[model samples]
Target: MHSSSRLFPVALVSAELRGDLTEDVYRLKPNNSPDPSVELALTRLGLPGREQRGAPVILVHGSFSNRRFWYSPRAIGLGPYLARAGFDVWIPEMRGHGLSPRNLDYSRNSVAAYARFDLPAIAAFVVEQGGQAPHWIGHSLGGTSLAAALGGGYLAPEQVASVALFGSQVSRDYWALKLPPVVWSGRFLLKRMGVIPGPRLRRGPEDEPIGLALEALRWYGLFGRFGERGNDWWAGLAEVRAPVLAVSAEGDRQDPPWACRKLFEQFGSEVREYLCLGRRQGFSENFGHVEMLVSKAAQREVWPQVLHWLERQALPLQANGAGGAAQGG
Candidate 1:
């Protein structure tokens, strides 16, 4: 492991050889973000002796979830699946989630901070350790942050090989929330709460800082846009030329297929594809937002499709022209 005093300091906190994969946990403290004490945790998984076999993949979890979403306590999840399949997988826990310690400004954490600081630092650390740019795969809010980073130009195309988003949507047409009075009331209530209690709300496993709620409000509110700066994230999508894969589910009412498709259509990548998981699409079951990535059915049917996307993205850009077919149900 490298010394922790260097620029983009990273420390290997633990390592163990699980059943078929080697799991290593790392702590990174980049000096760029607002809170220097904030250390992000990244869990890396790879085959016992083939750590350098394929392109590295960084998996970002959604809001209210952590690294366990990718690699559960029992060692059977997408992270392990990819590691066993010969891909170096790294799962990063967002601030205050999972193994990452909460920052002093945890109450003020938002997608802007994540896109401008966290993702770039994680990508830099991965590139420094792996000696190459990594392919990024994000779920829900994780994907939203990835989109913000890409559109805001925080994560340049040269730093990323490809992008994949599962159940991620930027459009908001929720009837209740769209009402001006409801938006005002919701924003007023969220401003008083330091954080939204996810457990109490039965939303997920962890609490989300109110900052995220406020950010979402601005996005879904009247005249809402995507980034912190005046940068039009939705419009800026047309500038990203990296290969992209946007996956949606027919059962994902939280982020519907049409909304997910809208986000996909904004991408300027000539080599982008859309996938909708449903029984009508030949999938065994109608995958929901979480089921699209976590359910056992996903392991059996959807994982191979993800693997195929990764393999295709690994190809040179010049060779991707013939591979631009958008597939879904």
Candidate 2:
């Protein structure tokens, strides 16, 4: 394949046909990458032999996870769900995860770097191809990076149609991490360990660099802020103007619903909605962090609602009837 495009120097890595969908994987070279070794992998999924009728959507996975979080080899998961619904679904694997090669300084890769370098490049490529702004859906730490990008001013509001975050949080209190001695000790151990093994831990297939853990701890340290250098991302969240949706699961102890809701409240977007997946919210059952979107219940109850949100910028009537509010975007 003569793969590189004119708008961006993305190289086509592979193409596979999965049932009714055509999957195209592209390698994106970051512009002014913090680590020159970084090259991102974006997998695009669409209907085969037909033009897509819906706008583009980007699915971002969280820490210690990969593209498989949103897709699988058998044409399963949310990426395929959106593709089948006529949405151009694209999934991006963060540096050193999935098809993306590890950076030379992989141990030091952090969310700040991803927000600053990777996401802008991705939005540019998708916009050029889709001929319009794309919607973004992120899970866990991926959502944190998305929020950081919008808060850090790397992504302009007009560049995206909407933003959705699942199982992501920053406001939850960690009293132990607030202490200096504990923070220092934790950081020391993490640096020595280097990386967190995903499979052994049963989190996912990709191992995450220790820098991600260190970054999280530092944010909870005494007087620590969420931004690098002197920037304050918490304060900057008030500057984001794009419509936002934050989804939380009742059983997600890792990122509890309260914390997720608090994070959503920080966003200054005038058009914003908060959703909780649980019996209280009329879901079949309370969802956990990983299964919130991966399970069959989500396929039956949540997926259609996601499509509704992308198309309408508002929650469905039944969602409001149950406890979820509709702040109509």
Candidate 3:
């Protein structure tokens, strides 16, 4: 039993052993006083016998994804990879995704809501349990939300030891979405459906609410800014002080390398590193969006580099190759 679970309004849903690792699942009540209900689930993994593991690292899945994206039931992927390396790995399945049950306002889920509410709760919880600031790794929209959390000041700088944004960028321009008529039309159509079927759309394994789609309206629409009600997250990114690493893939058409770089440059952190998962960076091949992290190539190539980043907080020695580290942690 986890001490945090016993102290907080949380339930130990399950405790399973997978080979040498232990997986503990917890269901937490919403930390919001107004919405004192359920919101999300966390899957924790750690070496069972280790008296003192490394620092905690929280992995946030992107849009149309869940905890399984980080750590599958078969005990594969980055979550387990970090766990085996003695890092306290935590995977959070956002509302209505994976182990998390949707609340009544399920259809109203948005990045703003996630940044302002869910992440704060998560950060507080992780700090409480791990007794230290946790490093954050987010994929795609997961990365975007984490950016929003930091930019909007919802997540304090001291609460974060470091942050890694994989395949994440908000600077990509959508000309069509910028038009008022187009934004209105798209919102109308999405509202009628309420949710986007991820599998049907061939996006991923999970479904997304209509509210998430409205981000384009806020970001690319008339007088667009990456925020709502006059809150500008894009400008806010300049205030972030945590050590930051931003990764972009050459083959990612969704969030191109240029745009990813643009977002990376927004961070005001004195310590910032930008990595490109492409041949130009000396990797074996030009890595695609999903393949950059989820493919077998990533397992063999990219994972070690990421693990090195988390462990050492330094940029990889890309000249050496995929599994290359910069002569340190």
- Alpha-carbon TM-score of each model against the true structure: 0.92, 0.96, 0.94
Model 2, TM vs. native: 0.96
Between candidates 2 and 3, which one is better according to TM-score?
2
All-Cα superposition RMSD per candidate? 3.7, 1.6, 2.9
Task: List residue ranges in candidate 1 displaced over 4 A.
Answer: 1-6, 175-180, 314-329
Candidate 1 per-residue lDDT over residues 183-240, each given as its tens digit: 8889789888888888999988989899898888888777677766678777888899
Comparing 1 and 2 on lDDT, the stronger one: 2
Best by TM-score: 2
lDDT of 3 by residue, 1-329 (tens): 45445435777789989888999888877567345555579988999987886799999999999988887678899999989988999999998999899877888789998899888888888888888999999999999999999999999876799999999998888888867888888988989998999999999999998888877677877677887776788889999989888888889999998898888888898877778888766677889988888889899978987887787777656534444312221
Clash numbers, per candidate: 0, 0, 0
Model 2 C-alpha lDDT per residue in residues 213-284, reported as the tens digit of each score: 888887877777778786788889988888899999988999999899888888888888888999877778
- Please report how far candidate 2 places residue 329 from its true position, in Å: 9.3
Model 1 TM-score relative to the real fold = 0.92
